[model samples]
Target: MDALTRRSFICGGAALAAMATMPAVAATGVKTLKNGKTTVDLVANKVLAQVGGVLELTIKKYGKVAVVRTSKGVKGFSVINLACPHAFVTVKRSGNGWVCSPPGHGSEFLLNGKLKVPPATTDLKAIKFTANSKLLTID
Candidate 1:
């Protein structure tokens, strides 16, 4: 309505937006395996976790996700997209169903998100998980 009011409003709006994008992400999902695809459709507040069992989930909203159940009853999870972050180019997908691309220099990572190749020293970002009851909640 006024100059000062407008400036304050704009600043407040910008801060709120920036905060939203900061990836303070909270997420939750339920998964079902179908045709080799584990579809994850749920709220961000729900977490993906290992609750004495395992689940494989593919989250469409972010990218492709992978989960594994260990022999010791442990669960592992990761997020991957074959699209290179630098150029948005499609990277080679591995037999393990992992995206093989690096952000900066030419480095490679394992499907489990471990660092492999060099020149780039970055690993894949992990998909956070939490557990409640028998549910594996991924965020």
Candidate 2:
């Protein structure tokens, strides 16, 4: 057998390590909600605080959704479907927005779920929600 190059060995090790961690990471921090309209009281939940606050919810009807309060004292918020429209890959937060989980796919989206990079042609789906007096009703 041929000798293994250092680069190949390192790359293989890294890939294995990432694969080992994926399942746990994928299973954690995802909340499952029944299919239907859902109400979230920010104050009562205490999960979403202020501007830049991001709350991840897994709606049975919509898969994964990220609720972000984007503005302070302005009641500006956005709900973005975290599932990649192209391949349904779970998107995760990266800097001011979100990116496809693998990162190598180069799919990125803005805070409003607009497509910002390639490999994904369509924008992420937006979930409708109303925020009033810290109460958010999502449909």
The most accurate candidate by TM-score is 2
Residue 122 of model 1 has an lDDT of 55
Clashing pairs in 2: none
Query: What is each predicted model's overall lDDT from 0 to 1?
Result: 0.42, 0.69
Provide backbone clash counts, one per model.
10, 0
Best lDDT among the predictions, by candidate number: 2
Screening candidate 1 with a backbone cut-off below 3 angstroms (N, C-alpha, C), the clashing residue pairs are 26-44, 27-44, 27-46, 28-46, 47-137, 47-138, 48-137, 48-138, 49-136, 49-137
Q: Give me the displacement of residue 122 in model 2, in angstroms.
A: 2.3
Residue-level lDDT of model 2, residues 1-139, one tens digit each, is: 4465565465445545554554322223333246567776677644466676677777778878887777755367788889898757787666667766542354778867899977799998988877786677788
Query: Model 2: runs farther than 4 Å from truth?
Result: 1-35, 73-75
